[model samples]
Target: MMNIKETIIFAPETFNLAETTRSIEVAKECSHVFHCIFMGYSKKYSYLIEESNFTFIHLEPHLSDKQITQIMNVDQMNGIKHPFTYEHIKERVQNEKRLIKIYQPVSIVIGTTLSMFISSRVCNTPLVYIKPLAYTRPYFEEGYLPSPFTSMNLLAATIKKLFISIALRITYKPKSFTKVAKEENVSLPKYTIDALDADYNLITTTPEISQVYNLPDHYQYIGPVYAKLDVPIPKFFDHLPTDQPIIYFAMGSSGSPNIIVKLLHILSELKVTVVCPMKRMIKSQLHKLSFNENIILCDFLPAHKISKFIDLSIIHGGEGTVQTACLTGKPFLGFGLQQEQRVNINQCVRFGNALSFRKKDFTKARMEQLINHALSTRTIKEKALEIQQVLKDINGPENAAKFLIKHFTVT
Candidate 1:
């Protein structure tokens, strides 16, 4: 007799590479026990789901390039410019309701999908969120979050923490979100962070890096789920010599091109070889600037796979990038662009696994000093390798799947 597998809907914001990949990895782990259906508005990363042999349903109200940019701006705390209009939210809710009726999912899983927070509750479906440790309530209460502004003194830090505490206590729900919730007869989320709440909130980082304690009963650690891109190795790696130290420089999708350009100018003069994947960000400036013989530029390289060849990494402190570096047993020098990234990098710094600097502290000499220091340091490498062993013992995706299957009742 064949036992039927219950349905589980995975809603990931496909515009963000890390979010999409994290969902895909976990879905792959859950595919055996659950019939996974991936739903999203963006088709940019649809191929990732398709390649993994999952059923992907493309939703309506597709986002434009400008709208995607605005969404990113909202995430970076720039402004309230986004595509979540009242009509759009209404339509999205309708679509989700339709999916729930048709699929009868045991649970709706999401990674940074704000719409699901409302829809899942309205539909009475269990919701599971794969989130970063930095966003958890315990992390916020710890006051480890630093201000993104240039000021790094005690007074400025204290004011920022106070402001954040106040904001978290107040009701800052979006108008469209409130309207949709009201129409559905569902209670609206009082605070902004309430959107991140779920029946099960799985933190995607290890305890050593986060160091956040006293989590709620519902929140659990699932280890780090970093990108393991399935791509062929670049041929340039063959020509590079092994005698010199190699540095992997990646300013992820959210990093600033201007900062990358400035750092490149300094790196060009160094004796170490630099393998930078910045073609997408610096396409217009590539022809104007001449590259050194030691520097190699490419469109992309799987950072997890190439960690063996590089001595150290210089990156914008993104969650996925930081986890990848730690998992691969390599030290990194992080330059965080936003508050979340700052917190991620700061956590690593606390663990003595990496060093970091702010954008305002950028200098030619400072960059050179940090790069040289990271490359020459033995303690950082040992600590990173130590964390790698810890990460290896726990498979984040598999554990997350097990937790979901055990906790939720399949209909």
Candidate 2:
């Protein structure tokens, strides 16, 4: 008699690159013991799932391009605006519940899929969330706040926290989701942090750098789960000279194109060679501006593959990008576009592996100054390399898979 494999549904918000890729990487590890099925509403990144040879189920109420853009902005914490409509949420919930009933999987692992939070509960299926440590409750309650750079006194900081607490209550509990959850007899989340809660919240950062006091057992601190994109080496890399220092500018999916353009012009004046992977985001800008012989622009570069050749990385501190920098042993200069990114960057700054600046201070001169410092400084490079040695040994994907197996064993 042949043994049947257990099913595990991996639902990721397909509109974002990091979220989609992270799910794929983790699902790859889980494939040995389970039949992994990828599901999402956006076709924007369906190709990534198909390329990995995973079975993808297209969900209904698909997200439009404009909605995806709106989501990106909301993710960046620009405002409280969202794209979830009553009809859309209703249809999504019904579809999610139907899929859950059909699969009856061990657990549903997700990456920022808001609908899964409700449907998983309705079906009584366990939900595992893959996210950065900053989103966890202990990180906030353990007083990772009153940041070092803040000039505010204790009273001011208290007021700020109070305001944020109120905001969380209002924004985290969206009307559509709350209404849907209540209709399905699911308990509504009281605070914003509750929205991110799952049966097993896999915090994707090393414990050493997470800086959260007294972490709970339910929240596992799996080391960085970064993407190892299967992309070919850029053609320009072959012809490039090895004498000059090479700087990697990776703003990631949410980085501002205007800032990238300005930074490129400044880099043009420097003696270093720049490898920038941003053709898709700045194609029009590229046509408008004259290229510097030292600057090479490509649609994408396998960051993990090229880290050895680069001297420094400049990035908009997305969690995945920061982890990739650490995993590859590259010292970086980070400019965070939002609160979550700021937390990720600040943790690296504390480790002395990177330098960061606020948006107000992110001028051309500051960018140049930091790049020069990171390139010349031996300590930053050494620290990054040290973290690299530690991270490479963790085997985050395998560990995460094991954690799931431990909780939900296949019999």
RMSD (Å) of each candidate, 1 decimal: 2.8, 2.3
Candidate 1 scores a C-alpha RMSD against the true structure in Å of 2.8
lDDT for each residue of candidate 2 in 1-411, tens digit (9 for 90 to 100):
987778899998887788888888888897887889999999878888999999999999989978887887887876667789777888999999999888889899998898899899999999999888775567766635426425478876777687556645654567888888889999856777866789888888886787675778778888888777888987777777788878888888777788788778878877789989988888767668886799888877788888767888888878889988888787898888887888899888888899987666556677678887887799988999887887778877787888887777766
Whole-model lDDT per candidate: 0.81, 0.82
In the range 150-210, model 1's lDDT, one tens digit per residue, is 2788888778777668857876777998888888888865677765688889988877667
Clashing residue pairs for model 2: none
For model 2, the stretches where C-alpha displacement exceeds 4 angstroms are 146-172
Q: Model 1: how far is 357 from its true place, Å?
A: 1.9
- Residue 264 deviation, candidate 1, in Å? 3.0
How many clashing pairs in candidate 2? 0
Every model's TM-score:
0.91, 0.93
**Which window of 10 residues has the lowest lDDT sum in candidate 2?**
142-151
